[model samples]
Target: MNEENTFETHRPRLFGLSYRLLGSRSDAEDVVQDAWLRWQQADHASIRDPEAWLVTAATRLGIDRLRAARVQRGRYVGPWLPEPAEIDEAPGPDHHAERAEQVSLAFLAVLERLGPEERAAYLLKEAFDYEYAQIAPLLGQSEANCRQMVHRARERVQAARPRFEVEPERHRKLLERFMHAASRGDQTAITALLREDARLVSDGGGKALAVIRPLLGRERIARLFWAAYRRRDPAIEWRMGMVNGEPAILRYRTGKLAAVMVATTDGERIVELLNVANPDKLGAGVTPDPGRASW
Candidate 1:
C-alpha cells in the first residue's frame, strides 16, 4: 500500500525541519505543503524510503526559496529582519509539539548566523542525526568537506553557548523584565538583565522603523530602548507572545506589529536581543493579533 496516512505521521518532523531552515511559521507550512505535493505527483508504488524523500524534498525546496529570498531582500526598505517564529510549549503541549517547538525556535535561531549550506549542514548533522557522509549529496559537497563544515559550524555555535538553557517559565520572566525596562526607561534594571557584552539587533526592512547596526554597550542600548519607547505612542500596545518557542513581545500600533522582540537569557542575564520590525517578513498573511499579549 502507498499508505496515504504515512505522510501525516511525518508531518511534525517536516514542519520542524522547514521552520528551522526558514525561521518562519508560514514558510515552514508552505515548504511542508510543497513536499506533500511532490509526493502526490510521484508514481509512488515503489518508493524505497519515503521519510528520506520527504526530508530531501523539503530541504531543497527551502534552499530554492531562500536563494530568491536573499536577492529580493537586498532591495528591502529600512531594515531586513527574519520572520518571528512562534511555537507552543505550554505545560500541556504534546510531546512532539514541545520538542518541535524548542528545536524550531531556540536551537534553530542559533543556526541563522551561518551560510545556508553551513546552517543546513549543522541542522542535519546535529539535530536530525544525519552523518556527514549522508549529508554530502544534499549540498553536492564531498563527505570530507561536509564533515569540515559541520565541525566548523559546531565550534562557532558552541563557543557562544549561554550559562544555562531557557525553560518556558524563566524565558517568560526574562521577557517581562526586558519589556518593562524598555517601557519605563529603567536603565538600572535593564543593565542587570542584559549581559555585559549583550548585543541588540533589529530589522525594520525599510518599510518599517528599526535600528540598523547591532547596538553595543549598556549606555548606548539603554538610550536606544529609552528613545524608542519614548517615541512610541503611549496608546500603542505590547503583548507577550511565544516566538521561537520562547517568550517574546509583539509590539503593535493600531492593528499592525511595530516590533517582535526575541530574548535569549544567560544564567544571570539576557545575552542577545533580536527585534524584528520588517513588515514584509512578518510571516505571510498572518495578521498581528491585537490580543496577542494574552498569550
Candidate 2:
C-alpha cells in the first residue's frame, strides 16, 4: 500500500484513542484530523509503526483539548455534556465514527467524575490494553505510578458503572422496550424493567425540562417521566437511535433537538438514564438520524 493507505489504515485506532480520551465526537474528529495532517506533513519513510505514533499523537491532542474543556466548562450554564453522535448498526462502519461510537454518554458522564490523568490512564490501559510501561511516558509519570492510576481510575469508574454489556444490537433491544414502557406512562411496567434504585440523570443545561438532580429509584423515575409527558404540551418527533454507541432516543420538535436519552441495563433491569437536554449544548453538530436502530 502507498503512504495514503498506510495512514488511512491507522485512522480508526487514532479516532478511538482520541474519542476515549476526550469523550466528544467533534473533538475526536479534530484530533484525528490533526494526526492526519501531521502525518501528511511528515516524512512517511522515516516513521515506523504508524498506528502507535498516531495513537500517541491523538491521545496527546485529546489531553490538551481536555485541559481547555476543563476551563471552558466553568463558564457553562446548568450542566455540561459532551457532544452526541449517531452510529449505524450496519456493516462497513467508518473508523472515526466507530471511535466516537464507543465513548457512550453513560461512559462519558462517568469520565466527568474523574480527573484528566485518571481518565487518560483508564482509557489507555483498560480500553486500549496498553501496558503500564507503554502508558507511563504518555502521562508523564513513572510506570509504577501509571499502573496505580489506571488501577484506581478503573475501580472508581467500575464502581460508578452499572454492570452491563457494550454490545450495541442487544443494547438496542433493551432500549426499545424502555421507550415503549416510558411512552405508555406505565409506571409498573417501567418499574418492573428497572432496577429498584435506578438513577435517571438529564443534562438540559437548565434550558429544558429535566430533573436537575439525578432521579433515583424506579418509582421516582417512573413518576418523573410520567409527569414530563403530562407537562409536555408540544408535539414531538422522536425515535430510537444510538448515541455514543449504546441505545438512545433522538427527540426534537420543529427544528431544535430537544433531548438525547440513554438507557443502561443491568441485564435484568434498566439501571440508569442519561438525558442530554441542554440547549446551549444543543449547538453541537451531532448526527443520530441514521442510528444503530431497528424499527
Candidate 3:
C-alpha cells in the first residue's frame, strides 16, 4: 500500500487516540493533520511499521496540545465538557461495552484530572490496548514508568468517572423519559428520573446562556429544567440521537445547532447530565437530521 493509503487506513484509530487524549475534536484533527505533515516528509522505505510511527507522532502532538489546553481551560468560563462526537448508531450484539465506556463524555471528563503524558500513557495502554513496551517508546518514557503512569491514571479515572448504564436500550429509554419530562416542564416526573445526588453540568463557554456552576441535587436540577422549559422559545427544536456512543438530545435553535446533551445513568436514574452548549464545540462530528424530531 502507498503511504497515503496506509495513513488513511489508520486515520480513525489515530483520531480516536487524539480525541481521547485531548478531549477536543478540533485539537485531535490538528494533531492528525500535523502527523500527516510529518508522514509526508518522512522516508517511508526506512519505516518498518507505518502505524507505529504515525501513532507516535499523533501521541506527541496530542501531548503538546493537551499541555496548551490545560492552560487555556484553567481560564475557561464555566464547566468544561469534552466536545461531543457524532458516532454512528450503536453496533450489533457483538460490540464490546468497553468501547463505548472508553469514549463516553463522562469518561473523558474523568480523564481531565490526569496530566498530559499520564493521560496518553493510560489511554494507549487501557483504551487502545497497546502494550506498555509499545507505549514507553511512544511517550519517550521507560516501560516501568509508563506502567506507573497507567496505574495512577487508572485509579484516578475509576474513582471519578460516573456510573453509566451500559445497555443501549435501557439508557436510551431513560433519556427519552427525562427529555419528555423536561419538555413538558414536569418537575415531578423529572425528579423521579434522577438520582438524589444527580449533577447537571452545562458548558456554554461564555458564548451562550448557561449556569456558571454545576447544578447539584435532583430537586434543584428539576427546578432549573422547569424554569428553562417555561422560557422555551418556539423556534427551539430537539432531537434524540447518539453522541459519543451513547444516547443524547440535540437542541437546535431556529434550525441551527445549539447544544448536545448526554446523560450518565446508574441503571434506573440519571447520575449526571453533560450538556455541551458552547457553539464552538457542537458541529464537529454531527449534523442535524431533519427527519428525526423528538419534540
RMSD (CA, Å), each prediction: 4.0, 4.8, 3.0
Q: Write the per-residue lDDT of candidate 1 for residues 190-295, one digit (tens) a residue.
A: 8878878887878886667677777886667888777766776776777666555456777767755566787667646787787877765664534334434542
Residue 56 lDDT in candidate 2: 74
Q: What is model 1's C-alpha RMSD?
A: 4.0
Per-residue error for 85 in candidate 2, Å, reads 3.3
Prediction-by-prediction clash tally: 7, 2, 0
Worst 10 residues of 1 by lDDT: 88-97
Residue 119 Cα positional deviation in candidate 3, in Å, after optimal superposition:
0.4
Model 1: residue 35 alpha-carbon error in angstroms: 2.1
TM-score of 3: 0.92
- In candidate 1, stretches whose alpha carbon ends up further than 4 angstroms from where it belongs are 1-4, 77-79, 87-109, 160-163, 166-168, 283-295
Q: Rate the local accuracy (lDDT) of all candidates.
A: 0.71, 0.72, 0.86
TM-score, every prediction: 0.81, 0.80, 0.92
Q: What is the lDDT of residue 105 in candidate 1?
A: 36
* True-vs-predicted CA distance for residue 152, candidate 3, Å: 0.7
TM-score of 1: 0.81
Which structure among the candidates has the greatest lDDT?
3
